[model samples]
Structure formats: C-alpha cells, structure tokens
Target: MYKLGYRNNNCIGCVKGGAGYWNKIRVDFPEVFKQRCKQSRAIGARLVRDSNGNRIFLDELSPDAGKYPDEPDFQCGFMCEIISKENNL
Candidate 1:
C-alpha cells in the first residue's frame, strides 16, 4: 500500500477510509469494493460522513465525491487519540 501511495496498510475498504480512498479501492479491487458496499448495506454501517456531517453509505457515494490524494493524507482518529492519551502525549 505504501508503494501504492497509501500511508498505512489497512484492509481494502477499511471503514476509516474516505470516499477518495474507497473510490481508489473500487478501481484497484473491484470485488472487495463491491463486497464492502454490500456489507455496509446489510449491516447499516456507514463508513463515512459528508462535508455536512451526514453519514453516507459506500454505495451512495459518488465516483466524483471526494478528492483523490496524490500523496497519503492520514488523519488521526479516536484510536490514535486513545493511544496518545495512554502514552501521555
């Protein structure tokens, strides 16, 4: 994934990923992308929110929705926050 310009080797269709990342997955790994959409629908788990903060399912995301990063742009999430707190950051 680093070779592909991803900062982390998270699973394809990782829930932490943004629409741009998912769209990249949709192209590079069609089956995995399809599976994620199907699974999200079945489980009612939206992996991302819009600029308006509305939860959005993968299937509902547009191919043109988000910006595709030319370089990895990782943002720290809750897990990172927890780890930082544990480390007294």
Candidate 2:
C-alpha cells in the first residue's frame, strides 16, 4: 500500500508536492511528467489544496487513483532516485 504524509505546503504522498522532488523529476525526466500531466488533464484533474493546506492532485485521494510511482517508468525512476538521494526514501 502507498503511505501518505505531508511536508510543508506539500503533500508528501503526491508527486505534485515538493519543488526539489518535482523539479528533479521534471528536469531529469521531462517526458514522464509531461505524459503524466497529459493523462491528468485528460481526466480533468488539478493540483488542489487539501484540508491540510498541502497541494495534491484530487485524483490521488481516490482509492482507485494512481500512485506517483505508478506513473510512467521514467517518472518512477526519477522519483525513486531523487527520494533516495534526498534520503526521503
């Protein structure tokens, strides 16, 4: 199961959080974030503020929603690598 948490104004459980995390993911893997955004936009999803004041994609709250790691392989690779690099893994 995917564990969820919060960090600052970010939802730790969602890839839309963490500038360093998302930036690295985008910089190192633009294609992945792009594709993921395409899919997200297709579903009319947006990065919304949760009750905790953290930003997270609305779809992420759904039980059937996709996890960050469940994104494209390149995106997953970047997330895992960056998380490990930042010692957040």
Candidate 3:
C-alpha cells in the first residue's frame, strides 16, 4: 500500500476505517468491504461519521465522503516524548 500512498498497511476492512478507506477497500477488496457492510449492519454498528459527526453505517457511507488515511509522520526523533528512549537501552 506504500505505492498506493497509504502510510500504514492497514488490515482490510478494519472496523476503525473511515469512509474513504472503506471506499478504497471497495475497489481494492470488494469482498471484504461487502462482508464488513453486511456484518456491521447486522450488528447495528456504525463505523463512520458524517460531515456532521453522526455515526453512519458503512453501506450508507457516501461514495464522496471522507479522504484516505494520511501517511502518519513518524519523524519525531527529538519531539516524541511519549516513550522514553533517552536511556538508549
């Protein structure tokens, strides 16, 4: 997926995926997307948020909704303090 501009190789049909991710999944992995839609709907689980922040079902997601996940910038050599690597263990 790096060649496809995806920062991380996210699992197909990940529940946390947004509409754009699902839309892309619909193209790259249609079967997975379809299965997710059916399953999520059956469980009444809305995995995407609308422009107004209302959670919506995957199948109900607009084709025009959302953008692909961003390539996260992991260049926090001196900025990230969440983990203490200063010890350089």
lDDT (Cα atoms) of all candidates against the true structure: 0.79, 0.46, 0.73
Query: Could you tell which candidate, 1 or 2, scores higher by TM-score?
Result: 1
Per-candidate TM-scores read 0.70, 0.34, 0.69
Per-model tally of clashing residue pairs: 0, 0, 0
Where in model 3 is the C-alpha error above 4 Å?
A: 69-89
Give lDDT tens digits, candidate 2, residues 1-89. 12322223232234444333443345445676566556666876665444465655533433233343433322245666677779865
Backbone clashes (count) for model 1:
0
The local lDDT score (0 to 100) that residue 38 gets in candidate 1 is 98
Q: What is the lDDT of residue 86 in candidate 1?
A: 92
List, residue by residue over 19-89, the lDDT tens digit for candidate 3: 77778788888899899999999999999888899999988888878777651222324333333356442
Tell me, by lDDT, which candidate is best: 1
Q: What is the lDDT of residue 80 in candidate 3?
A: 35
Which of 2 and 3 is the better model by TM-score?
A: 3
lDDT of 1: 0.79
Give the poorly placed runs of model 2, Cα more than 4 Å off: 1-16, 48-89
**Residue-level lDDT for 55 in candidate 1:** 90
